[model samples]
Target: MQIIKAVYINEMFKISKKKKICTSLIFLLLSVIVAAIVVYSLNNFAGVSVTGSSEFSVMVLTILSYSLFPLFTAFICIDMFAGEFADHTIKFTLTGPASRLNVFLGKILAIATFIASNLIVVAVLSFLFSLFLNGGISNPLRIIISYIMAFLPIFIFALTVVLISNFSRGTTSAFMFSIFVFLVFVGLSVAFPQIKSFLFTSSFDWYKLILGSYINVGKIFRIFLILLGYGLMLFAAGYYLFEKKDI
Candidate 1:
């Protein structure tokens, strides 16, 4: 436990030193600014007042979940695994006192922490901006729940990226492969809606279940189980490869 904590802290420190983290923050701020502009235009020009706090946050989350979040996860996972391998820096980590399993868990936890932080920042920033535009939020609890629930699916996606990164020899290959796999699954879900519920990609919108007027506990539990299955399988597979790698 102590080793894992140490590794987690160390990994986070390493991630903090990366420029991508700053870039992600800048992109998020820009996205919020652009969203605010569009909302302003619609309200003034189109005469549509859709500047509700909850609604604004949802719109921003929709744009992010479908695009930025997944891409950022892929980039971070690639940097944590594939890029380390390419740079021959993974050896330093592997030579530490921590066991391979502990190291793996720490790294995964670090990525998850980063994702959660990003979600929090987006939620807070959007909510503050929404307050400026709309004066108050309608359902602050619902928006908070939505953002909290969102972490699961995105972390599952991160597990998928971690699995891909383990098998990739370079960051470029890892990123391309991750995007390809993501797009393929998304396409499959679109073409075959029947199986959409089972795909982790489709579950990215699982927050809708909570945000709905009537929350279906049973349905939410069923989807949670499916996502949990995917997360476990991906983690196991990723760790197996990580353990076997000649770092």
Candidate 2:
């Protein structure tokens, strides 16, 4: 299992590299770097100068966990599963020593690795640099918790993209369609905030789960369980389709 997992990870990165996706991955890295720079440079709030560092840190992490990092990752990963079929490698690869479940888990882990690592890097870099944000609590525990909290939303998102990829079978079009579908979903959900709790975006507010103080953490966990259940259902559906699919 370990060896196959390693090979799977290598193959995943190799695919990313060959597709020139690694270059784009720099944006994820750069976002973190930029956040750290912003936090360190303008800790004094520039003009207002009244809002404390905690406020700024919260704002920065919120943006990172919510809009910026997630949307960017969504773009990068929308093709994850479809790309395999696009390249005509799904059969040869999945029927190997790896089980279908392993394949799904492996692909998920690969995507999660990139997302989680980027979040961690951003959190650590921003946390260390946030020291300049005078009132920012340098509590290491909070920072760790913050990074862990960031992963939930990413997992929910990556799985969504992966599941969506099962429909199109081509990386480029699947990716494009996934984004279109996402926009439509967002638009409808926003138009009716009364039912917002049912939308993935509403539940994806992990930054609020940690950075904000109003919501109960238990509710956040419940939302995560819902997302996980959705992810598993998508994976099962995708796997069934793949098992009977003509490649």
Candidate 3:
């Protein structure tokens, strides 16, 4: 436990010392600004009638979370994992007393922490922006539920990126490969409708479970199982590959 904690802290400190976190936050702020403008314009100028703050926030959050979060998380994971290996700084960490397993799990935890924090920040900002644009929150509970459920896809993407990072030889390779996979999934999800439900990317919009008029428990559970299975598989594969690598 202590070893894992040390690795987590070290990873966090290393990331904090870099500009990636700052860059991510800046992007989040820009996204919020852009979303706010669009939402406000649609309501005020375009004469679209929205329910209230919750609906406005949900619209913005859906777009940002579904699109931006995956891309942002992939880059972050690539920098954290593949960048270390590419620069050979991973050797320094591996040389420590902590076992590879502990280090690997710790890194995963660190990535999750970073992503969760960023998502929470964006959710808050989105809600506040909605309040500023609209009068009040229409369905606070539903928006909150949406925020929590959205993290499911973010973590799934993180795991996939980590696997790509571990398998690839360099940061560029990791980033490119991960992005390629992302695009492929997004493309396939749209291009092929029949198998959409089977694709993990299809399940990324799990937030719809809350937004819809009817909540299907069975469908939600199935999506949850699919995501959970994929996450475990990706994490296990990445860990195995990382363990086998001559770090």
Candidate 4:
């Protein structure tokens, strides 16, 4: 337990020194700025007063969650997982007192914490920025609920990228493969639009389940199960590969 804790701490320290603070701040700023612009433009020129509407909040949340957040998470995970491996830096950590499982768990924890924290910040900042723009959140509870549901997809994305990173030879290859997979998912969704619920990317807007007049408990549960299952599978595969690979 102590060794695992030490691994986690060391992983965090390494990530901190990489100075992701600037990138996170930029993301937060971009989300708020773009959302505010969209809201302003809609209200002024389009004769649409989306200010404080459930729809407005949903729109912002959907854009942030479904698009930007996932892509951002992929880059971050690639950096933490594949980039370090490609650079031959992860070997030093592998030589620590921590076992492979401990090191894996530590890396996972660090990545998860970083991604979750950024998402939380984006959620809060988007809400507050909307409020400042007089685009009040119609149902603050719904916003909270949506953000909660959003976490699962983010986790699933991180795990999938981690798996790819572990399998790929270099960071560039890992990143390209990740993009290819993302594109493939998008293509599949387009090809079989009806079966989107079963697709992980389909749940990028899972928050929409909570935004409507009628909450679909069955659909929500199904989405939850799908994401959870994918996360577990990806984690298992990534761990197996990481554990067996000679660093």
- Maximum-TM-score candidate: 1
Task: Write the candidate numbers in order of decreasing TM-score.
Answer: 1, 3, 4, 2
Tens-digit per-residue lDDT, 1-247, candidate 1 = 8999999999999999999999999998899888988897888799887744347888788789989999888899999999999999989999999999999999999999999999999999999978877777878898898999899999999999999999887899899999999999999999999999989989888887877679999989999999999989999999999999987
Best by lDDT: 1
Q: Point out the higher-scoring one by lDDT: 2 or 4.
A: 4
Ranking by lDDT: 1, 3, 4, 2
Model 2: how far is 156 from its true place, Å? 1.6
Off by over 4 Å in 2: 2-7, 12-21, 33-45, 49-57, 66-68, 75-79, 135-140, 210-215
TM-score of 3: 0.94
List clash counts for every candidate, in order: 0, 0, 0, 2
Tell me which residue pairs clash in candidate 4: 52-135, 52-136
TM-score of each: 0.97, 0.79, 0.94, 0.92
Which 10-residue window of candidate 4 scores lowest in summed lDDT?
A: 50-59
lDDT of 2 at 75: 55
Model 3, residue 153: distance off in Å is 1.4
The predicted structure with the larger lDDT, 1 or 4, is 1
Q: Of models 3 and 4, which has the larger TM-score?
A: 3
* Model 3 residue 56 CA deviation in Å: 2.0
Q: State in Å the error of residue 111, model 3.
A: 0.7
lDDT of 1: 0.90
- Answer with 2 or 4, whichever has the higher TM-score: 4
